[model samples]
Target: MPIEHAMNTISERHRADILIIGGGAAGLLAALAARRKARERSIVDSDFRIVVLERNARPGAKIRISGGGKCNVTHDGAVGEMLVQGFFRKSEQRFLRPALYAFTNDDLRRMLRKRSVPTAVRDDGKVFPVSGRACDVLAAIEAELRDASVDVVTGTRVRSCLRQNGVFCIHTKMSDFFSSRLVLATGGVSYRHTGTTGDGLHIAASFGHDLVPSSPSLAPFFLRHPVAAALSGVALRDVQLSFRTPSETVSRKGDVLLTHKGLSGPACFSLSRDAADLMRRESGGEALVNFFPDFSAEDMQEMLLRHASAHGKQLIRKFLQLQSAIPSGMIPLVLKQAAIEGDIGWGSLTKNARCRLQRTLQSFSFGEVKAIPLDAGEVSAGGIALGQVNAKTMESRICRDLFLCGEILDYAGEVGGFNLQAAFSTGWLAGSSSASGSAGTGV
Candidate 1:
C-alpha cells in the first residue's frame, strides 16, 4: 500500500496493440499470452503492444488473500462440471472452453514451480503452491509477467473509454491510452478491499456490453434464530446446507462456521453462491441446514431414542451435556427450547419430552432469507452474456477485434478455483486472438 506514483510512473500518453485494464488473473494471463504470441519484435508488432494497468499498486492482491492465503489456484475436479451446471449457460461454457484448454491447471502449477514456489495438489485435486502461502502464488505470477516482458503499469486508473475510428481509446487519470485490442480482466465486485470495485462492469457497459447486477456470492448468512445466536461460535463439520427455491432443493456438503450473522466456510460459501443468485431478486429464498447431514431424519430419531433409552437414569440437562452431538454450553438452552425441564433424569423423561427431543434434533428449520449483500461474498454472479462470443476463440461478435474473457463476460463458475480457471481459459484465448484481431464474442 506504500506505492507512490513518482514521475517515472506517469511517463506519457501511449498506444499499444493490446491494452488490458486490470492486472488480476485474467489481465496478467493476457499479458503472458500476448508476450508469447507476438509475431515479431519490431514496433510493427510490439508483441501486441501489451500494457496491463492495475489500480492496485501491487498485482494479485486478491490472489494473495485467496483460499485463506493458501491460494487455491484451481479445483481438483473434472473441468466439465465446472463449465456446466454451476451457473453459466451453454454458450458461456463454450466461450470458456478454448482458453481453459490452452492453459490447464497443470500448466499453472508448472509455472509456479519454476518460480521457486513448489506446489502440492490436495487429494481433492485443488492445486496449491507448496508454501501454502498466497504471497508465493502472487510471486510466481508476478515472475511470469516479468519474464514474459509484460508492460505492467500498477496504480494506473482508467477514467473513461471511447470508440474512435473503430479503435478504443481509454482515458485514465494517469494518462490516455489507445490499443488495437482491449481486454478487461477487472474482475467482479467481490473483495473491494483487493481493488475489484466493479470497475470492469462500468468499462464494459460503456463499450455496449450488458451489465448484470452482481450480488454477494459465497458469503455468510444472517439467521434470526436465538438458538443460532447461542450456538454462533460453534463450528459444524460435514454439514449439509440445502438451498431452497420455490421449485427446487439443492444441497452442498462441507463444513460451516456458525457466525453471529449466520453460516460461513465451504459448506456455507458453496451454498451461498446459489443463495445469492436465487435470492438476487426481490423474492426471498431460504437455506435450510441439516447439521447431522450424514444421517437421515429417521436415522437421527433412532439415534436419539437409543441414547435416551440408554441414559434413562440421567436428566435431560445431563443428557445434552454428556452427548457430543451438540455443544456443551448449549445443552441447557437446547433442552429448554425443546420444552423439556433440565432437572429430570433420563429415566424420569415423559413420552412428550422424548418426542420433543426427537423432533428438535431430527430436522431443524431456519427462517426465510431476506438478503445476502454483494460485499459479503467471495465472488459475484452474472456477467456479459456469453451467447455473443465465440466459444473456441473467446472472440466477441458484438465488436470486431474485441475479445471477452474472465468475469467480464457472464460466465461465473463455482467457488474453489473454478472461477480462476475460467479466467485463465478465456484470458488465454483473448490474448492469443488479440494479435490477429479476428476474435469475436463467442457467438
Candidate 2:
C-alpha cells in the first residue's frame, strides 16, 4: 500500500483502545500481541481496536537493516541461557526474567515459522531467517498484524503525548489520536536515521517516569592513533579488551576486528559502554588488548622461551607470525612497542627485550581512544528507569494504563540478537497486560 493511503486510512479513526507509538520491533509485536490476547479473551475486534503510529514511511526500519540485512531475529537458546550469556548485569537479568520467560526465543521462532519464515542458527548462536533477508522477518510480522486486523499508520511523526482525564492524547503531524491505553516503544536515540529519535523518552518523562541518562552502547571506538591501512581488515579471535577507570578495570573477551579507524567486533562492542562512560567523565583513555587471552603471562613467557631456544636461527618477526598467530602487518607495530628489532634472531634476544616482548604480548596497548560515537552504536544505553515500570507487565507505575517496552526502557543487552529479543519479550508482556486491563506491581 502507498504511504499516503496508509496515513489517510488512520485520519478518520482518531480513537483506539490500545495506541502504540513507534512501529519498530516493539510496536509491531505489541500490536499483534494485543490483538491475539483480545481474541483469546473472546473480545470482538469492534470492541477493541489496536493502532500503531510510525514516523517512517514503513515500519521495521531498524529490523530491515539489522544483522547486515539478514536480520538476527533472536539468539538461539533457552531463557536461562540467554539471560546468562546475553545480559551481564544482575539487575537487568532479574527485571527481564518474567518477560523473557513469557516470550522465549522459541516462541519468537515458532511465530515466524508459522508464517513460513524458517530460521537457522549460526555456529555462534545468532539466529537468522533461512532466506537470509531481513525483509522476510518484517514481512512475517506485518502479515500477522494484518491477519489480526491491526491498523498501522506510517509516515506520521508524533509531536507530543499526554494524558487528560484518564485518556491519552497523542498529537501527530497528520492527526490527533486518543486512547485509553498507550504503549511507548519509540526505541532509543541511536540510529536516528531509522526514526528512533528518543521521542518515547520525552513522552515517558512527561508522564512522571524517571529516566536513566542516555549513552552509547555497543559502539566502536575512534582511536587517537588509527590502525595502519594494511592492518585495517585484520581480525583476531578470543582476544580480551580492557579499559581502566578510576574505580576499577573493565574487561571483555571475544573476537575483534581492527577497523581503519580503531576497533570493532564483539570484544570492542562489549567494552564500549564502559569506555564511553569513562571517556564522558575523563577526556580520553587507552584500551589494552590481550591477543592471547587464553594464556597467562607466565604461560606465554615459557612458551616463547622454549620456542626461542629451539629456533635460535629464526627471526623474531617470522616466529611471531607463524607461531604466535600475530598478523604480518602487525609485527612491526608490536616490535616497535616492545622496543625490539623485528629482524633480530631469537637467539640474539636479550633478557630485557624478551621480557618487554612478553609484556607487550600480554597487554598490548590498542591506542588512546578519542571517543565512542553515540550515533554509531547498534543500541544505546539508558532509557526510562526500570524502577518506574512493572517488570511483569511493562506498565508504568506512575501512569495508569500507560505501558513501556523495547529500547525505551533502561535495559540494553549485548549484541547477537539480545536487544531484539528484549524488545519482543517486553512488547508481548506490555500488550497482554494492557489488553487484559491488569495492573502490575512495580518492582
Candidate 3:
C-alpha cells in the first residue's frame, strides 16, 4: 500500500542531481543506481540529489501484475536475443547486456532469497522470482531504493519539463523539481489502469524525439469458427502456432490456450507482435493461422491412406483408435472440414478423402485476428526509435539531459520474462550513465 492519496505538496521548487520519472521497474533501477554511484550524498545536497516520481500510489504495480500475478523479473537466456537477429536493435540490446549478464537470473534469485521468494525455472529457461508473489518483486526494488536512501515521491504526476542553463526543470502536480539529468521511464500505453497512460510520450514528443508508431503486442486473438467457441477453454501443450504472411510462413511450438475469444498462451503471445502489426496493416482484415504445424500435408496424407487401407474393415472410430487422445467430438468436425464424409468406415476411405484429411491436419486455417484491446495487452511494439538515443547513456539525442528507457523505447520481447529484463537493463544504463563521473555531483 505504498500508493498515497492525491495530495499536492505545493512546494515552490526542489533540486536534484538526477531526476527519474515513473517508478516502475526502470525508474526504480535508475534511482538505485544513482544512489550507489553517488554514495553518502544527502537528499537535500545540491551536489548529489536523486529523486524518483511515480504517479501510482506504489511503484512496480505493473511488475506486480505480470505472469498471472507472478512477476517474471528476467530471463535465463543469453543476452544476445535483445538485438538484431535476437529481436531488438543492436544498441538497445547492447545496453542490456552489461547488467543482464552482470546481475543474471542467479543474482536476482539471491536478492529475492532473503525475502523467502522461491524461484523455479521452466523448461524454456524462463525464471520466476520463486515467491510467486508480485510483492516480493516490488519489495526487492523498494528495499534497494530505501537502502540507498534514494528519495522516492509517489503520486506525483508530471506536467512538463523546461531546460534552462544546463539543468532541466520538472513541473508536476505535487511540486516542481530541477535536476541536471532526467530519466523518462513512464512506460507505454498497454495497461492504462496501472498508470501507463502515455504521459512520457507527450513529454518526450514536446522535446523533439523521433518516435516509432506503437501498437499492442502479446495480445489475444479472435476467431470466427464455431468449434473455436466450443473449445474455448481447452488447452493443449506441445501445440504449434503457424502464421502465414504474404511472403513467409513462420511456426512456433509450445503451450497453446483456447480462450473464449480465440487462441492465446505461449504460442500466441510469441506471435502477437507481428500478428497485431500485420492485422493493423490490413485494416481489420483477417490473417491465416494453423494450430497444427508439426505434421506436414504429405505426412497426414500418408497416415490417413495407411489407416484406411488397414482399418477399412473397422468403423471410423476404429481407424482413429490409435490416436484416441484427440477428442472424439473434434474428429468428426476435422474430418468433415477435410471433406471426409462422417459415415464412411476406415476401410471404405478413398485416396481423395485421405488427401482432404491431410489438408485439415497440415493447415487448419483459423480466421483473422481482431482488434486488440489496449488494456488487455502486456506490452506495446513501438516506442522511441533506437537510433535517436545514445544507447550507452540512454540520453535523448534531441534533448540534452533527457533520457528514455523501458516501454518508452522500442525494446520489447515475448511473454515469459524479456520485458522486465528490458526495464532493468535500460534503467541501469540510464542511472549509471547519468550518475557516472561527470554528469552530476549529487546522488
Q: Judging by lDDT against the true structure, name the best candidate.
A: 2
lDDT tens digits, residue span 216-237, model 1: 6677776655344667778665
**Candidates' C-alpha lDDT:** 0.70, 0.86, 0.70
Q: What does the lDDT come to for candidate 3?
A: 0.70
Candidate 1 deviant stretches above 4 angstroms: 1-13, 39-47, 81-95, 224-232, 243-250, 281-287, 306-311, 317-323, 345-352, 366-370, 437-443
Stretches off by above 4 angstroms in model 2 are 1-12, 245-247, 438-443
lDDT of 3 by residue, 1-443 (tens): 11111112323236677899999888888887777666633333344768898888888888888888877776665566433323543555665565565445565666667556767777766678666778888887787777777888888889898776666777887667877789999998887999988888888888888778878777766655424467777765566676565655546676667777777787777777776666566555343334345566666667667766766776665454445334554566566667766667876766676676666655655655555555567888778887788876778889877888788887667776778877776787788777776667321
Determine which window of 10 residues in candidate 1 has minimal summed lDDT.
1-10
Which candidate number maximizes TM-score? 2
| TM-score of each model, in listed order | 0.85, 0.94, 0.87
lDDT of 1 at 48: 44
Instruction: Give residue 161's error in model 2 in angstroms.
Output: 1.1
| Residue lDDT tens for model 2, 1-443 | 33333334554488788999989888888998898888888888877888999999999999999998999989998888999888888889998999998788999999999999999999999999999999999999999999999999898999898676566778897668877789999999998989988888888888888889899899998888888877888887787888765566778998778998998999889888888888888767888888788898889899889988999999988878884446777788889999999899999999889989998887888878878998999999999999888999998999889989999898888888999999999999888888884311110
Sort by lDDT, best first: what order?
Answer: 2, 3, 1
RMSD to the hidden true structure, all candidates:
5.6, 4.6, 5.0
